[model samples]
Target: MQSPIHETTELEELEEFVINFRMRRLKLGFSQTDVGSVVGKLYGKALSQPTISRFEVLNLSYYKMCYLQTLLQKWLEETEDSLKHSSDLTGFYPFTTYQPIERGRLSQRSFTRAFMHNPKPTSEEFGYLAERLGMEKKVVRIWFYNR
Candidate 1:
C-alpha cells in the first residue's frame, strides 16, 4: 500500500486524505450506517452515529481515525499525525545544565542596592521567597531577615 500521508501542515493534504478515505469506502460499497456501527464499536455507543458524523464533518483528527480504522478497515495513521503535533522535542531532549557561579553574578554593593529597593520584607515574605527558591526560610532569612 502507498504511504497514508503525502504532506504535513497542508490543508490540501488533509482534505485529500479525507476525500480519498471516503471515496475508497464508497468503492467498497459501505454505507453511513455501516460506518456508524464500527464507530459505535470503536468509540463506544456513547459517541453514537450522529457524534461520529459530526466528528467526520469537523475533520477532528482523533475521532476521524477512530471512526475510520473500525469503520473502513484502515489502520488509521492517527499515531503518526498525532506525533507530528506533539510537543517540541527540546522538552524531551536533555541539555547541558548550567549553574550560576559563586560570588554571585553581581557585587555585594549591587546586591544590597537592589535588595534595599523592596520594602522591608516580613517573615511571611521571606517564607514565600524561600519557597519559591526551593530553600529553607533560614537560608533566605539571613538575606532579608535581619530587618
Candidate 2:
C-alpha cells in the first residue's frame, strides 16, 4: 500500500532542505557509506543505512522527512562530539492511550467489554469466556485492566 504526500507551494521548501542537506554532507567530504553508517547507528538498525538512501525513491512523507531532518540536525550538532553518546537518549513511561477494550468491543476480547455492556460478568463468568477463547483467566484480567 502506498501513502500520500502533500503537494503544495511548501513542497519546494522541503526539496530545498533535502538538497541542501545532501550538499552540506558532500562539502564535509562524507561519502554515502559514511552517512549510511551514521544513520544505521542513529536508528540502531544496520539495514536503516540503505533505507535512508531509499528515501529518494520512497520520497518519504513530510512528517517522515521531518524525523530524518531532526536526526540530521543532531548529526550536525554532534559531528565533533562522541557518536556513541548519540544513541537513543529517549525514555518512555508506562502509560498507553490505546484502549484494548475498544478493539474487544468487536472481537479479540469478550469477557470484558462485550459482557460489561449487557451484563457485568463475574470472574467465574470471565473464566468460562476465556476458556472458549483459549486464553487464561489471568490473561483476561490483564486485558480488562489494559482495556
Candidate 3:
C-alpha cells in the first residue's frame, strides 16, 4: 500500500496538470464545450461540458484525471504541431467547431427535417447526429421518442 504522503503528492501534481491543461486549452481558443467535443471524438467517449468543467476544477477521481491529462497532453501536442505547420490556423484541428452550439438549443428546421426523415433513428445514427449537431445522444433520442 502507498503512503498517504505519496497519494497527496500525486493529487497535487494532478491539480497542477489540470490548471495547466485549462490554461493551454484557453490559449488555443477552445471553450470547455469545444474541448469536451474534440476530446470525446478523439477518445470515442462523449464528454460533456460539465464533465470538462469538473476535470478543470479537480473534482474528478485520480484515475479519471490521469486519463484526461493523457488525452489533453496528446491534443495539445497535436495542436502545437498544427500551429507550427499550418499557415491558415483558422481550421487547423479536425474537430474544431467554428460555431459551437449550446446545449438543448437545436434549430426547429433541423429538428423538423430529421424528424420527417425518421422519427426513431438508430443508436448509430443518433450518435452521429448528436455529435454533428453538438447535442447529446440522449437528447436526440428523447426528441425522436417524444415526436
Q: By lDDT, who's the top model here? A: 3
Better of 2 and 3 by lDDT: 3
Overall local distance difference test of candidate 1: 0.47
lDDT of each: 0.47, 0.54, 0.76
Residue 49, candidate 2: alpha-carbon lDDT: 47
Q: How many residue pairs clash in each candidate?
A: 0, 0, 0
Give, for candidate 2, the lowest lDDT window spanning 10 residues: 91-100
lDDT, candidate 2, 71-118, per-residue tens: 766665565343345522221101111122233343454554555674
Best by TM-score: 3
Clashing pairs in 1: none
- 10-128 per-residue lDDT for model 1 (tens digits): 44645566666666545434344444543344446434455445545654675465444454343234322333677332222122111122223333443365367765767887666
Q: Of models 1 and 2, which has the larger lDDT? A: 2
Q: On residues 1-147, what C-alpha lDDT tens digit does candidate 3 reach at each position? A: 999999999988888888888888877667788777676776777678898999999888888888888888887787778878984444664443334234334445677788888887889989887766656789878878877
| TM-scores of all predicted structures | 0.30, 0.39, 0.62
> Which rank order by lDDT, best down to worst?
3, 2, 1
